[model samples]
Target: MSKLEDLKTAVINGKRKDVKTIVPELLESGADPVEMLEQALIPAMSVVGERFKKNEIFVPEMLVSARAMKEAMKIIEPILIEAGVKPEFKALIGTVEGDLHDIGKNLVATMWKGAGFDVVDLGVNVSPAAFVQAIEEHSPHLVGLSALLTTTMPAMRDTVEKIRGAGHDKVKVLIGGAPVTLEFAREIGADGYASDAASAVDAAREILAS
Candidate 1:
């Protein structure tokens, strides 16, 4: 396989060290940062997501691949920015108040970044007021609320309510977590629901496209 293809395979295999080595080599050979992202990093994550959805891979596998892509992005993002290559969309993600879990939220953030979105992670235990403030501040195209406990689900609902209550009609709200469901998302008036990070990317793209 070609070096770019090798980069793709390295990401898919969760080979972080190889990704670190190959990205610089490609850049030194005058590879376009945009091409590297579009051809290798993003596609690698997409394949990982598909395999995850099919149960051929699981969370550990997905995390490692996402991390690999992250390593590649660390080198490429600065070049893209210095070249004025901006991502098409911005996303804000946070774990709701009363919930401390962040594995799922962090995974989604990594996946979204891999998919080429400008992501702003709001961190765990974020309040409705904080979400509203972030909406006002960032004006993100997408907002993801994660809640891992059934007990903390109400905070998720409240965050969505606050977002709408703040009159930010243009932003799309996407919710997910171990305990969150499509039904709950709808009942809470979220724009989309995702079972995992990969599905979150698909849902975010779909919601934004429409």
Candidate 2:
């Protein structure tokens, strides 16, 4: 197989050593950094996301793939930046206050990064005021609130309210987690909802487009 295709397979297989080796080789061989990102890295993560959505693979498997992708990106990102490549959208993500569950939140952040968005992860147990403060500081196009427990769902609602109340009219709020539904998202004034990491990419794109 071609080197780029090999790189894609290595990422899908979560072969970090292979990715670490191949990325630099591709760059030294005059491969386009952006092409490596858009073609090999992004598509590999897309496949990983689809597998997760189908239960064909679980979180452990997904994490390895994401780590491999991150390794490849570490090599490619500098080249892209030096070439004046920048992501078109910026996103901030965090788990709501009182919910320390970050597995779901981390997965969504990786997916957003894979899909070419510049993502700032605010970590777990982020407060409504923190979300609003971050939105003010970063001016991101999107914000994601995660709540794993039913109890923390109200915190998600409060966060969305605070973001809107802060008058950041253009920033779209996306909500998701085990207990968060489309109905809950609407009730909380979120612009979009994703059932899982795979769909979060699509939801963010759709919400931004609208």
Highest TM-score model number: 2
Candidate 2 Cα outliers beyond 4 Å, as residue runs? none
Tens-digit lDDT string for candidate 2 (26-87): 98999998889888988998898888878899888988998999898888888889989988
What lDDT score belongs to each candidate, Candidate 1 first? Answer: 0.92, 0.91
Q: Write the per-residue lDDT of candidate 1 for residues 48-126, one digit (tens) a residue.
A: 8889878899889888998899899899989999999988899999999999999889988987987889999999999
**How does each model score on TM-score?**
0.91, 0.93
Residue 41 lDDT in model 1?
86
Clashing residue pairs found in predicted model 2:
none
Clashes found in each candidate (C-alpha, N, C closer than 3 A): 0, 0
User: What is the Cα-based lDDT of residue 186 in candidate 2?
Assistant: 88
Score candidate 1 by TM-score against the native: 0.91
Worst 10 residues of 1 by lDDT: 107-116
